[model samples]
Target: MRQLFGNRAFVLLMVSDFMQNIGIWIRNMALLFFIMEKSNHDPVAVSLLTVIEYVPIFVISMIGGVLADRWRPKRTMIWGDVLSFLSILLILFVVLAGYWQAVFAVTLVSAVVSQFSQPSSMKIIKRCLPDEHVPAATALSQTLMSLFIILGPMVGTTIYQTFGLLASLISLLVLFAASAIVLTFLPSSVDQAPDTTESAGSLLKDMKAGFSYIASSRLLKVLLVVYVVLALGSGLVQPLDIFVITERLQLDMSSVQWFTALEGLGMLIGGLIAAVIAGKVKGTYLLFAGLSFLGLSTFVEVLSQWPMLTGTMRFLTGVLMAMAQTVLMAVMMQQVDEKFIGRLGGVMMPVFTGMMLIGSGFTGWYMSATSIVVVYFTAGALFLLSSFISMKLPISREPVQEEAEAPVSVNATVKV
Candidate 1:
């Protein structure tokens, strides 16, 4: 762990990632409540925020992957931060002008630009860290994310409640500026050779190759299916979170922060746990067990009206999610070739986002027609179903070292 942190390039990249994630969450929390208030808690409008945030990922993730492969990872990441900083400025101006609707538009634009950052960041990590340190790097990254999740909402909600929209926007602006500055220190040397062979037709072929790669691996295909299903279930229930706090629990907007904070705390602990058991435990076991625990926790939350119980359930859900996601990310980092990292992320974006879109859309309409509880119950069932299906995958108890030494490349023949 200390060795990973000692590397200057890795440190700078993590700093940039931390700042960007914090800024994004802070902005999201403020904007979400604002929309809730302006729309008078309308489910469709509130749900649109999730849709707009993900639509770009669905539309441009593939293109972003190709660009990440072709471009310098550091340069791509820095440009993404620059674009995000500019978007924050636009949001500030929109808020100052009292053009509330424009905030959502700006958020959508920012999401589109932000797609380039993740793939590029992953590419950079692959370059900077030795194969042995990849798991540590991933765990540390997840830990940072958990920290932001813990702090962002509490801080954002406080500022929004005490200061105003303008203050929240300014806070985001400062964070983005810091992120851009931090990212500038990242090494400019090329990490991998650019794909000079790419032509007009090459993009489509590259994309098809990514899909084929996934189709050929039973383990990859099953994981993808399970994750997509999980996203669908999540989309159905996530947007209803605000309603659950406010309407179901009879609490105020501020109370939602407690739920978020506890969840983040759980994630932080989960990350630490993943770090300890990284090489020893099979990712397959963690993935399935975590999903099962998370699903059961979600069901518990739906059944409870007590705030303390609900908060505990949310926290447990976070821990399990972090455990599952950390392992999932580590496995991907270990198994995939550096060249296809971006494209794999691109392929994943649409699957996750598309499922989320469906979940959000269905929840929005279904809740309007029925109730939140029904959606919760249905989503829980899906989670259990995903866990059950995962049992059939070819995941083994073998250490990630085995896979790291034998990476599956973009052009590898599909395994029957």
Candidate 2:
């Protein structure tokens, strides 16, 4: 653990990610409340904000992924943050012009840039750390995120409520600038761009190659299916989670705030446990176990009216989710060639996002036709199905293709 923390690249990345998390939560909470006030609590406006945030992931992830592969990971990441900063700066001005609705652009710009930036981040992890350190690094990263999940809303809410939208936007600008500065210190590395003579069609050809690469890997295929299926399930209950508090537990709407906090608290504990065990465990098995138990636990939540029981189940659900995602990320890092990380994510994430969007759209109609209990049941069943199917994933830890013999030069990998 000390060795991993002392690695300069890893340390810098984590710091950058921490700042990015702060910026994200600030955007999420501050914008949400601000829009609620300006739009007079119109459900359509709120729903449109959600769509704006997600639609970019569905539309732009692949393009960003492909581009990320052809660009230096460090440089791509820095540019992504810089661009996000500039975009937010622009939004701030438009809002100052009395067009508060321009706040939606903040989410849209960040979402679009993240498609490019996030893939580079995965690639950077593969480049900067040895194969063995990846799991611990992922655990640490997940733990930081869990920390944010637990506290981000409070911080964001506090800032927005106390200082208002202008202050929140300015905070995001500083955060993004800070994140970009942190990325500047990462170990210098090269990407897998084609020769200078390559034509414009090279991007298309690269994307096609990416598709073939995914097709060739049975584990990758199964993983994509697992993610999409799980997304479908989670989407069904995500928007309606408050209903769990109001209907099942017979609690007030206000209780939903504290009620949802359990998952974040659970994730913090779960991330610590996963980090400790990740290196020793078979990730595929962990994935299966997490999902299966999480499914059962979620279903258990539906069966009880007791606050203690339901809250315990939510906490357990968070633990299972964190463990599952931590291991799965480790697996992907170990299995896919570093160069293909961007392309692979590009294809997989958008499909997963698309499935989620599709499922979310269908949910309201399905619930009206049936019942909220039926909807939650459907989510649990889908999770179980994804888990069972994930049993088909290969147990091999070997990469499908060898990565570049060395991407980061020795001198560039300065350890603290």
Candidate 3:
């Protein structure tokens, strides 16, 4: 732990990411509330905001991944931050102009840029840290995100409630600018590889190579299948979570807020646990265990009406989710070649996003036709099924280890 924290580059990257995530979540909360108010609590209108945000991920994530592989990670990341900052500025102007609807467009633009930024950031982390530290690093990064999940809404809500939309936008602008500036000082290259000239035609070939590589790896194939299936379940839950808290729990909005806070706390704890046990334990086993826990928690939540029990279930759900994702990320980092991180991100993002979109749309109709509880039950079932199927894969029984020849040069300079 000390070693990981002692790295200057890691700490700086974490700080920048912390600020950016806070700004993004706060903006997300502000927009959700703004839409709810403007649409007079229409579920469809509110859900439409989520749809718009994810649509770009479905449309452009694969292309962005390809770009990430071709471009230097630092440069790609810096440009992404700049674009996000500009989008926030545009949203601020739209808010000032009383064009509430324009926020949707701004959100879409930010999400599109994120496809590039997210993969680039991953590439940097993969290159900067040693293979052994990847799990702890992944944990720490996720733990910070859990912290934001806890605080972002509270902070965003407080600011929005007090100072209004302009203040929120201004906060995002500052955060993005800070992130971009910090990113600029990072090393241009951590490892020197022979440069090769490639024509535009090579890009298509590269894309094909990425797909073929994933298809060829039995481990990656199983992981990808499980990932897409889980995304489908999460898609159903995310859009309808508020409804479960308000309608089923028979609680007010404050209850929903508290549930989120508790869940974040659980995730923080889970991340720490995952970090501690990472290299010692089989990540594939952890992944399946987390999925099973998620299913059990969801099932329990539906069976109980007591607020305390439901909240506890939610917290447990968060713990399971954090553990599962942390292990999954560690496994991916260890298994995939560092050179293909960008391409892997590209392939994975579209699969997750596209399935999620389909699930969310179907869930909306399913809820209208059946019941919210049924949807919850469905999610729980999918999670359990994912766990069972994952058990059959050989990767689940094998522990992850650093490759005999590490890809990233540990001695490579990371300026600032």
Candidate 4:
């Protein structure tokens, strides 16, 4: 871990990711609070906001992928951060101006732009890092992200309570600016571009090509399905957390914030575990174990409605989810060609995002019409189904190669 961070580019990337993640969490908490508190809206409204925020990623992720492949990843990331910063500024302006509806609209636009930025940033990391360190590197990145997740909500809630939403927006904007500055110093490399001669074909053909790539690859197909199910199942728990704390447990808002923080703490631990064990274990086995834990944790929540038990279950769920996600991402990075990483991410984003949207909406509706316990049971069942499906899929392992005679020069740029 120390050696990994010794690479300046990796350190820079980690710092930038950390800043942006902090901003993301703050913005997310603010959006949730704004909808639930200020707007006096229900879960459906929160779901709608989430849908609008994520729908663009589903729609534009492919375009973002193509662009990431065609352009220099670092430059793309810089521009993306710039746009995100601007968007935050716009949100801050609206909040300051007291136009709450306009703030929502601006927030949606900002989310769309951020979605476009994500693929490029991911591509840059893939390009800059060598194959061996990728998993640890990715784990470290996620660890930093989880740390921000731990801090952002607590800090945002405090700021919101003391200084109101406008102050929180301003803090997010400052963080975004810092992220942009950190990203600007990284190395740059363009992703592989599609052949111009093939560009004249039908749009459907291009779409089919992307789908065909996944279809032909057995491992990707299974992984994609697993993630889709995971997204759907996990989505149920997020919105329901608030409901569980307020309605079922009769806890105040501060306890809800603590629950979020505890979940982040669990995720940090999971990421650390992945980092330590990544080189030692087969990615597939780790993934399966993680998924199993996730399903079991969800079931625990369903059976044990006690606040302490439920919170502990949520913490365990975070750990399992982080392990699965970190390992999956690292495995995918290793197995998939660099040129297609962005597109693969693009294809997966919508399926995952859509699942989350549906899950959040379903949980909200279920909570309103039925009981929180019922929602937990349904979520657990879905997770179990996903785990079962994952077990049947063949594991795709990276091909082993002879060790390089010498360390690859850190400054050398490699074309994908």
- Which clashing pairs does model 2 show? none
- Put down candidate 1 lDDT per residue, 54-78, tens digits, no spaces: 7888798998886676667877777
lDDT of each: 0.78, 0.82, 0.78, 0.73
- Tens-place lDDT per residue, model 2, 221-266, is 8999999999998888887877888888899989987767888888
TM-score of each: 0.81, 0.91, 0.85, 0.81
Which residue ranges in model 1 land beyond 4 Å of their true spot? 29-50, 92-104, 160-171, 188-190, 195-201, 239-257, 302-311, 363-377, 391-416
- Order the candidates by TM-score, highest first — what do you get? 2, 3, 4, 1
Best by lDDT: 2
TM-score quality measure for candidate 4: 0.81
RMSD of each: 5.3, 4.9, 5.1, 6.3
Q: lDDT rank, highest first?
A: 2, 3, 1, 4
lDDT of 1: 0.78
Superposition TM-score, candidate 2 onto the true structure: 0.91
Pairs that collide in candidate 3 are none
CA displacement after TM-score superposition, residue 317 of candidate 4 (Å) = 3.0
